[model samples]
Target: MSKKKNKSKTLKNEPSSLHLFDQIYNNPHFHDIVFLIGKEETKAYGHKLVLSMNSPIWKGMFYTQEWMETKGREECLVRIPDLDPKVFLGFLEWIYTRKAKISHTTIYGIYKLAHKYCMPDLKQYCTVRFRKILNGRNCLRHAERSVIEGISKWHKISLKYLMQNSKKFMNNGKCFAGLREETVRTILEMKNLNCPEILLFRALKYWAENIQNDLIKKNKTEIYERILINPDQKKITARKLVKKYLHLIRLDLMDFKNYNELIKSGYYDHRILLKEGFNVVKKFDLKAKTKSRSGPQLSDSKILLIGWCRSGETHVNDLINSLKSGGIENVTHMDPTVSIPSLKAMQRYDAIVVRSSNVNSFYKGGNLGSNLAKYVDEGNGVIVIAINTLINNPEKQIRGKFQNQNYIPLKIAERERSEQCSLGKVFKPNHPIMRDVKTFKCKEYSHFIKTNDLNGGHIIASWDNGYPLITEKRRNDNSGIVVCLNFHPISTRITNDCGKAWLQETDGNLIFSNTLSYLIKDKLSKLAQKNPKKKIFYKK
Candidate 1:
């Protein structure tokens, strides 16, 4: 009983760990070190033992061989250049008390210091705190500043986080000022950026103008005299600031109104516009073609055709002709079986069409389909044509190929067999793909593949037996579009042939053209809506 009572008293008398830290922090009477930080030579106090224990940098400074011979037992003075006194104080407080006050203004500085001092826990704490403070209003400023001042590793982390989470903030025009040229180019290159290309141009213009104004303010008399001599020189000088970054912007993505406004605003040089071969009259003519019932014509869009085509086969050629007839201007055919292009090369095209004779071989070759799925996620368009061989063996061919990919819209059924082609009914008659399309006709022995709806994909057209024949899925925010046609839309058949390819003049051709048009139009329309007005340019 007496021992138990003694133990209870001992427990009551002992202080908690936090209380001990607070006591150590409050008792500054025996501080043995002083850090002079920043230009003002501000002093920060801490115990050498505590500092050395918490920071490897401090340990090296106090206990290394040279230090022990010079100033080991004496009071030590260290200078930290360019570091804010308050930030250093926060660091010291954390070292002594296991707690520190962190805010937006001080977070980056503290993170830098913590990294330099090899304090992983403190660095992690600052990183978490900084992420929490990121929002639509402040993300741009934080990102710009971090890139400008952070180390390479920290810069990468900050940029990756901003790209994934702070897209809304990047849309604000004010965020563009004072950015590095490489940073601006990187942002423009992102496929999934929510901002329009035109707005990005305006932002680049604003930044260039601001940089010129700052230069003029700093060299007031010289610049003023030069400008007075040649009034056009000011415009020339401002354009020079952003010239290197200009070509990275995709001028083709801009609509007619926005493109015209950019030209008239005098933000870019006439020589550069001419070099890009941008003719105002041609642009206007192209805009006029967007009003067709097939939806907007993709005259400026680039389409990539991937797969093999035999010399005598007219299916691929016929489809290409149909697309060209519907006003698509640029189409490149590539045989992925020969050599799969890199993702960067693939991104040059606006839409991708994949046709494979052996679906299993295509799936196993260099992760092409998965990479294409990533491309689709970045606000592009994809059309996948599953051949009869793939459809007839859904388990071994279709599901096996696409088991790990989410880009395919349809889920394959277990049972796979060939069935006589029946007349297909328009599942959604009002859908853009079915705008002028009525009954879909196909050749006999054209295998009908069964599919389940996946990724919110709805049946755009179905067979008379109610099996889905066509599926369409649009991603969130309309970032991308995917359409899967179960049967070949383009075929080569003689007039008397029964089980040949689709007829060139059949409804299948029209539907295929309309689907391509709709996907391209949707992508362009969203780009136009990214920033609808010029007012955002004046925000800063």
Candidate 2:
């Protein structure tokens, strides 16, 4: 009688066969989902099953998604392939429910996927695994693309982390071993590869494979020529090379995806994806015979920052990113010591800005940084920051000077390791530079000395320290305004959520863009300057 009662109770409590409970144990996509072998995959991999991809799923598969959702985030089974079934399930349970766990193996797979999908958080998690197994040659290939793709995703990738794995990759990995010279040259010229030691390996790779034949041909040709034209064979960085060759893939470039359609549109070459990229500066005639009919032109009106050590891209991101977010992204950063091609890039800017830090780098007679000083006197109403050198190291001043000035030999420690913020923290709301920064936030980085040195300099803002935080000095009877000061800037605001919170969130670049707008409009009255203020929005 007890057995008969229990049987009746079970029949009453059982779910119908048509329900999701039956489907979960049967569906191929659901039941045999990829094995996530590792604590990371077991824990975070559950997100995949629950992912709300709106793309159509079959009506029959509806129950699969439903059951997975009902099971909850912490109670999923993630079995590793080729493992004892019971053991793997038990390990997955520990990881998902925090009961027991397994070693990490699915990390490399997930990391590559995370990178592809622009998952910043997940990519960071993969970084830990990459760093942990830096010595393991087994994972370098997967790891290399992970870092590269992540760098392509973020505004500026910190290479310090990847440097640790360099030696391990050099030991015996095919990814490092079989790297083509064109590929090596591409990375080097793009400024993507990091570290001197790592750089040496890539250089060694390029020389051993790609450059060897080219070097012999070049030597023979040079010997045949009677005249010798002095040349400076510039060393291209991997990051820069990638930028020159690959279409701007900081994110993905949108060329037509359907290959056959693109070819059918009277185009010849379909192999080269992302059609709008070339080494413009490297090309003899800045134009390329792209398969796409669109011709490349003198583009990117880059703002050439002429400043002392105070602005090392510390805060310019806010303004730069803001305009970028609203279908109006213009500007790329170039520092004097870090990237000098920027000086030549100056031809691109519609109007120029001379910041306080810039003044010291160009002015201050006898200082190495002061060599560029003559331009500051031009004052095309160029917005100059209010200051001299951020620090008083004579050696630093010497290193700042150009090659002809005999300052190149003296290598002073740059502020690469130091954080310098101007003690002054106030701003005058009415200044021209302030015209664009609606955030009204002051910069907090170390600024060089602000001199009332110019007789006509206007004090637009000041800090509690009584130093001028923002000032603009008139030059040549207002032909230009040399902005000089130590006030906080909008760049700090852009990076933090103070102003716009999008455009990959770097230091205030959009504010810098707005400032450029103001300067350009101020210089050439005929030029149309868009309404003041950083374009506050998110781009991508």
Candidate 3:
């Protein structure tokens, strides 16, 4: 036998505490047991943990320092990948508190820790603050680098995004081509930049280049006037000429790093107000789906969305993606434009959601055919994308002060309504979506919807102009509730107009979370009823 054999035997008897601790700490509640047992005697008194102790994935989501060491570095918050230095400080607070609060600060080192160390709760805090400080037109160079750090972290988390947006990075004009292809490939493979901010930087890098081609040739006669007269007049070195002008280009001052302190230390609350939807909507639910799965009675089902991947699609894709990711059982989709119309093809889903305004039907008149509206109205569960928008305008407005679970419309129009942010606007304080929305400071901007017959509907979200942007109607004249929204926010008149997309980030967060919750609650309750929990009451 060898000394290695002797050591291996000792290891088997002693057991690796790191491995055992990792197995146990994953269940946060287990700490309570140790606490109950008293700390000094924990090593011997605690029961041995084995692979059998595997907890559900949810329990595993919580990470500890030991775990962080095992996972490589970096944490990612999907909210804002550009964890600019401003976002970094907030991440620090989140790490300390385990609660994500919005902050505006630029501290790259802290964000780097959050991204590397499995610190999402902290990362989210940083993202909120970053968003606050950088909301307006006054973006500076110091803040950009920090945001770039965040973007890089998110790249570590989502290759889907990197793979999807690769072309955009190549096209954004970064002197990427100037850099050696091998270097560019390594950076891209490493996911080194926030995709969007990376796009912006690449653009800036191009503009900063000194190279140029004379489009319409200027007279060289004047060019010779100074150089030809030369040293007799005054001599200047090439480096001197370059350095002097380098001081002149104010754009060179654009560094994301420097402005980050303002994000952390400045008036961020006011910045959040600069976004049109800041106050109008709310942040993400982050509210986890309860494992209990209690409530209504139903069967295992799936939802198929039609017209989702059409020529124009917006929030629909995001909503569907979220439901699937959240583990909300029983959901699927087939964009009407993507699949050929056939009753058999459409019949696969227990529920069908039409996500766009354009209507194409295989269910219209044939045997396999069920009338489009009638088919949905009679289904077990159906979500109709702005049904009214199918026959009307593609854009819709979002406004009405939410109040007592209802919106008292300040204004209503058949077409898209401008942002109706009015002082009179009121919203339901207790509404789940509005819970985070109350603190949202708002900036005014408009989103369009394809809708009609605004009367006799419950307004869920409204515009500051005091008009209803999202409404639901349930009445005797019509049975199924009408979820009135837009055909596509991106396709509407606001593509680049007022940054309806940027400002509405919160709205997208709110509306999608709410709608998905509604569908999940409705679907899950019904299913839970069929699978009742066993009773286990006892008496002495």
Candidate 4:
């Protein structure tokens, strides 16, 4: 009979299995289980079979003897205490139709519900969604939750975001005060926080004041300030409120001026401030997570002086004394003829100052020029004083090793002259390296290593013959600073047998000291750029 000529037709009039389950979700007539949820006790309907198939917790609860005994009773209801109705409703929807409605407002609640119900897939989905919606405004809250839930990944990501926007978060009055005490302590404990310590202290003060005021209100007191008496007759003060987290701040690393201001503010106890002051003075903090977040100060920076340090000569000693007078106290003298430090050892210094009366010693130990070039590339500053060498001399070996340094910012040629009246005229007097440097006195017959090609460096000062005296060039990648002083090292102030031909005045000292200061400032500025704050040049 040709199989009764059966016709194949689409079932367009009926809903699919998933769509039918979704349509009947939360309908009391079709669901066997009724969930009374939240403080409002809102009702959510769920099918036992559908819930049991999705979650083992639901499966075990539904198959219990107590639930089986009341299977046919209409009064049987599952009470989901302390859960939002919307969150429970979303959970039921996922069980029935494999879809969830997730938003920022309900995500945290939904995640908790999913975790409580032993739903790994839903928990993973929520974790991915958390990453997408995280920002500066919500990072602290999310980080707090992550720590509680032991979710290490989101905790790290959230804290990293907090560190990036720490200046804004700490400076904003409302946001800073609204943070929970534990959350505030967690942020304070971070090692890489680059915000100023004074701002952190102020935020802590605001947070403590708010907490103290809240305690006062709870005790039915009229106190507006931080000091109040609680119901148990215990005194509440700002210091007591912030005592647990106070020591997390690196008080030793803060500027002494700011530390004094913190003491004057009177938010913390005098004993705490005194102890921190002791730590600062002793250069010792056993609890400090870092030495300095903003990079080394001029006093803390190490300078490598590679030059002649003869017992009777003051050429290198003069430079060292001037640098120390300008707050650069850590200068190490390394005679190039004796030994040249490894590149790894050279990285320990913030800058290197190279001055030599004889260029032959540069190639004595190792490749000093190449190591210096690599040092500058690794973000350290270099100052080259080529005043003693003769660039036009027919000595190829001496001149070749000196001229091969790519880190030198200028091209040296045969454009030099010996003149006793070759005074330095400041072109960029406002420049940091030229600060307080008007004119430097030239010693008797000082050799001027004049250069016409500056190689894109700015002339801070010049010879009377229009040659570049002191030129500054920053690396193309902004990694380091190079300052070239095109005058004889004999022009430096010294007191020795050859003091007649050497410099012996304050102008030379002021210029050299200012040049070292400028290089350190530039180096710290570069280090600050690696952090999250806006690029700001370190002001003298």
How many clashes does each candidate structure show, in the order listed?
Answer: 3, 77, 74, 2
Give the residue spans of candidate 4 off by over 4 A: 1-20, 39-41, 63-66, 73-76, 103-105, 145-157, 178-180, 219-234, 242-244, 252-260, 267-540
Worst 10 residues of 1 by lDDT: 286-295
lDDT of 3 by residue, 344-456 (tens): 55556544555443344322222212333333333223444442223333221111111112221122324453452322243454543343443221234444543334655
TM-score for all predictions?
0.46, 0.30, 0.32, 0.44
Query: Tens digit of lDDT per residue, candidate 2, span 1-540?
Result: 999999999998886543333233222343423455544443223223332221123123434767558645443554444334434443223223322222245544554544444545545655554455544344434334444444432211212223334444444323444333333433333322223322233334333433334334566344222112123534423333223332322211112332233235322233443365633233322232212111111122344544334544545554344434322334555443432333334545544443334323433324323433333333333443322333345423423433223211111122221133322343566543454343332333343353333243456554344545455544444344444434333443435543212223332343344455455545543222332443421111
Q: Residues 1-540, candidate 4, lDDT per residue (tens digit)?
A: 444433223355456776668777888786677889987779888788878877899899888888788775353677777777887777777767777887767777777778888999888888788878887677778887787777776786687677667777666655555555567777776655657777777777787887767765665343323233344666666777666667876676766666766778775566865665665555534444433345324555788987773433456676677667654657998876667777898999888887665344444423666677677776678888765433554331123332464446677566354666455577787887776565665655555666678766778788776777788776577658878888755544444444324455536666677787777777776677777476643311
Among these predictions, the greatest TM-score belongs to 1
1 or 4: which has the higher TM-score? 1
What C-alpha RMSD separates each model from the true structure?
16.3, 23.3, 23.4, 19.4
- Per-residue lDDT for 340 in model 2? 36
List the pairs of residues colliding in candidate 4.
387-487, 493-503
Number of colliding residue pairs in model 4 = 2
lDDT of 1 by residue, 1-540 (tens): 999999999999998754576566625467777788999998776777877878889888888889878767777778887888888888878877767898888887888888888999998888777777776666556656776675454554555555555445645666777565566666665433445666677777787687678665666545443232244444446677566567766665666776667777775676777887978666665544212012353555788887664432455676576566554657787765467766798889877877655333243443565567667777778887755423445322323223345556766543344555655677678888877676565565554456655546778887676767778776577568888777754554333363635544567766667778777767666666775762221000
- Candidate 4, residue 342: Cα displacement in angstroms equals 29
